[model samples]
Target chain A: MLTCKDFLSELSDYLDDSVDSEIKAKLEEHIKACPNCWVVCDTTRKTIQVYKGQTECSIPLDIHARLMAAIEKKCAERGK
Target chain B: MSAPGSEAIVSEESGDLALARTGDAQAFANLIQRYEGKIFRLAQHITQNREDAEDVLQETFLKAYTHLDQFQGNSKFYTWIVRIAVNQALMKLRKRKTDRTVSMDEGIDTGEDIVAREIATWDPSPEEQYGREELAEILDSAVQSLAPAYRTVFVLRDIEDLSTEETAAALDLSIPAVKSRLLRARLQLREKLTKFFKHKGDDAFAYM
Candidate 1:
C-alpha cells in the first residue's frame, strides 16, 4: 500500500510524467487499494489539468504581425 | 512572409548561424517567427499582463539579434531566446515595484475573495459547476497570484515544462533556489485550492 508520504512525494512527478514506469506501476497498484491515495491522485490530476488549460493564451495575430515586422526591420538595418 | 513549413526556409534557418551573423535577414526573421509565440507566452505567463509581455518579447528579440554572433551552437536557439525573454520579464517586473506590492501576511483581497465567492456560488452538481476547465482556470489564477519570485520558478518548471537545470540557467538562479522556490510555489497553490475545496464543500469535487 502506498502511504500518504509516498503518494504525495511522487505526485508532482506523476503529473509531470517524469516518474519511471516501475514506480508508476507501483503507484497505480497502490491507488487501487488506497482511497486516500486515489483522492490525492484525482485532485492532483485535476490540478494539473486545470493548470495546463488556463495557461494557454493565444498570441494575438496583430502582435505576431508587429513582432515579425520589427524583426524584419532589424534584419534590414543590420543588412545595410 | 514564407510558408510555415517551407522546406527552403527551414533549411535556411537550420543552416549555420554564421549565415545569420553575416546579416541573413530572412534567416533571422525565420528564427524570430519560429520563436515569437513561445517567447510571448513565457513573458505573458511571468508578467500576467499583455503589455508587459509584449515589451518582453520585443526586448528579447532585439537582444538576441544584437548578440546573434555570440551564440555558440551548444544550447538550443529557443532556449537562448527564452533566457532572454525571462530576463526581460523579470527586469520589467522589478521596475514595476510600485504596481502591486507582494505584501507579507497579505490579507485576502477582492481578487481572491471574488474567486471564492464564485466557487461558493457554484452549482450543486460538482461536474456541472466545477468542470475541468473551471478548475484549471482557478489554478491558473492561483499561480498568477504568487509573487514574481515564486511565480517565475513555478511557471518555468511546471507550466513551461523546463527541466530544473534549464530553469536555473534561464533565471540565473542556483538549482537549489529553483527547486526550493518551485516546491514552495506548488505548496502554496495546493493550500489555496485546499481552502477553496474546504469552503465550497460538496460542489468542489463531489464528482471525484
Candidate 2:
C-alpha cells in the first residue's frame, strides 16, 4: 500500500509514465483509496494541461523584422 | 505534447536543415519562421521580461545560424534550437541578476503529511472561464511567481514538452535533480492555480 507520501514522491515519474508497472499499480491503488491524492493528481495534470493549452505568443512584427534583418546581415557577412 | 507547429517543422526539417547549413538564407528563415513564436514564448517565460525575451529570441536564431554546422543532427532541430534558446534566456536572466542557484541535491519536502491543502475540484474547463487575454495574464503571473529555477524546469518540461532526458541535459542537472524540481514545480503551480480554479457555489465563480 503506497502511502500518500510515497505517491507524492513518485508523482512525477508516475505522471510521466516512467515508473515501472509494479510501482504504478501501487500508486494507482493509493490514489484510488485516497481522495486527497486523487485530487492532487487530477489537479496537477490539469495544471500542465492548462499551460500546454496556451497559444504561443506571436512574435511582435517589429521584433520579427529585426530578427530577419539580423539574419540577412549575418548571411551577407558569411557570404563575404 | 509537442508544441503547436512543431510536427510540420519536423517533417520539413531535413531539407531545411541541409540548405540552412549551406548558408541558404531562405532555408534558415523558414526554420526561424517555424519556431520563432514558440522560442519567444519560451524566452519570455524564462526571462519574465519582454525586452529580454526579444533579445533572447534574436540571439538564439542568430547563434543558430552562425553555428549551423555545429548541430550534429542527433536531436530534433526543435530540440537543438530549444537548447540554444534556453541558454540565451538563462543568460539574459543571469545578466539581470535575478537568477538563483538551486543545489541539485537540495531536498524538496514531499513528506507524508504534505498532501495538497486546496483539494476543491476545479470547473471542468477552468481555462474557458476566462477570456484569452485574461487567461494568458493569469497564467503568466502564476508562472512568474515561481522561482526561476523551478519556473525554467516547468516551462521546458511541461509547457515546451521537452523529454526529461532532454530537459536534464539542457539544464545541466542530474536526472534525479530534474525530476525533483519538476515535481516541486508541478505541485506548486497546481496549488497556485487552485485559488483561481476552485469551484464555487451558485455564483459560478470564474478565475479572476
Candidate 3:
C-alpha cells in the first residue's frame, strides 16, 4: 500500500507522466482511497491549469522601443 | 496545412540566422524583432521589476548579437534566447543577493500524512476567472509570493508552455529536478490561493 507520503512524493512525476506503470497504478489506488491526497493532487493540477490560463502580457511599448535602440547602438558599435 | 505561411517564416528565420552569423547586423535585428517580446516577458517575470527586466532585455540581445557564433542551431532560437535571458535575469538577482537564493528543498518535506486546508473550490472555474480583473491581480501576486527557484521554473514550464525537457535544458537541471520543482511550485501556489479564497469567502465561492 502506497502511503500518502509515498503518493505525494511521486505526485509530480505521476502527473508529469514520467513514472512507470506499476507505480502509477499504486498511486492511483492510493489517491482513490485518500481524500487528502486527492485534494492535494487535484488542487495542484487545477492550480497549474489556472496559472496557465492567465493572460499573456508584453513589455511596454516605450520599453521595447528603448530596447531596440539600445541593441541597435551596440550592434552599430560592433560594426565600427 | 502548415498554418498558411509558417513554413516560410521558419525558412526565413534560418536564412536570417545564417546571415546573422556572417556579420549581417540587419539580419540579427530581424531576429531580435521576432523574439524580443518573448525574451522581454521572460525577463520581466523572472526579475519581477520593469527596469531590471529592461536591463536584462538589453543585455540578453546584446550578448546574443555578440555571441552569435555560440549558437549552433541545435535548439529553437526562441529557446536559446530564453535560456540566455534566464541567465541574465538570474545574474541580476544574484547581484542583489537578498532573497534570490531559495533552497530547492524548502517546504518539500511533506513526507507525512497530508493536511487539507479549507480551500474553496472555484465556482465558475479558473478559465472563467481569467476575465475577472481582481483575480488576475491575485494570481500575479500568488506567483510572486513563491521563492525565485520555484517561480522561474513555474513561469518557464507552465506560463511559457515549455516541455519538461526544454525547461530542464533551459535551467540546466535534471528532468526529475524540474518535475519536482514544478510540482512544489504548483502546490504552494494552490495553497496560497486556497487560503486567499477561504478568507475572502465570497470571491471564489460566489457562484456556489
- Winning model by DockQ: 2
DockQ of each: 0.34, 0.74, 0.52
Model 3's interface RMSD: 2.4
Sorted on DockQ, best first, the list reads 2, 3, 1
Candidate 2: where is the Cα deviation over 4 Å?
B1-11, B98-115, B201-208
Stretches > 4 Å off in candidate 1:
A1-7, A17-34, A53-57, B1-13, B16-18, B99-139, B174-177, B191-208
Compared with the true structure, what per-residue lDDT tens digits does model 2 show for residues B102-196? 33233344434335777777889997898988988888999988767788889989888889989887778888878888888888888989989
Residue A36 deviation, candidate 1, in Å?
Answer: 3.6
Per residue, candidate 3 scores C-alpha lDDT tens digits across B1-208 of: 1358978988999999999999887898899888787787778777788788889999999888888899979987778888899999988877786763644344344423233454455443654544578777788888888777788889998888788888998889898778778877777787887765433444654677
All candidates: TM-score of chain A: 0.64, 0.87, 0.92
Which residue runs of candidate 3 sit more than 4 Å off their true CA positions?
Answer: B1-10, B97-120, B127-131, B197-208
B79-155 in candidate 1: lDDT tens per residue? 68888888888777767867464321132232221111122222222334576777656666888888777788778
Worst 10 residues of 2 chain B by lDDT: B102-111
Cα-based lDDT at residue A27, candidate 2? 91
Whole-model alpha-carbon lDDT for candidate 2? 0.83
Best model number under TM-score: 2
Instruction: Flag clash pairs in model 1.
Output: A50-B136
**Model 1 agreement with the true structure over A1-80: per-residue lDDT tens digits:** 66656666566667667789999988888878877566555654554444555545557998888887787787678668
Q: Per-residue lDDT of A21-63 in model 3, one digit per residue for the tens?
A: 9999999999889877886787777777777676466557898
Candidate 1 lDDT at B145 equals 83
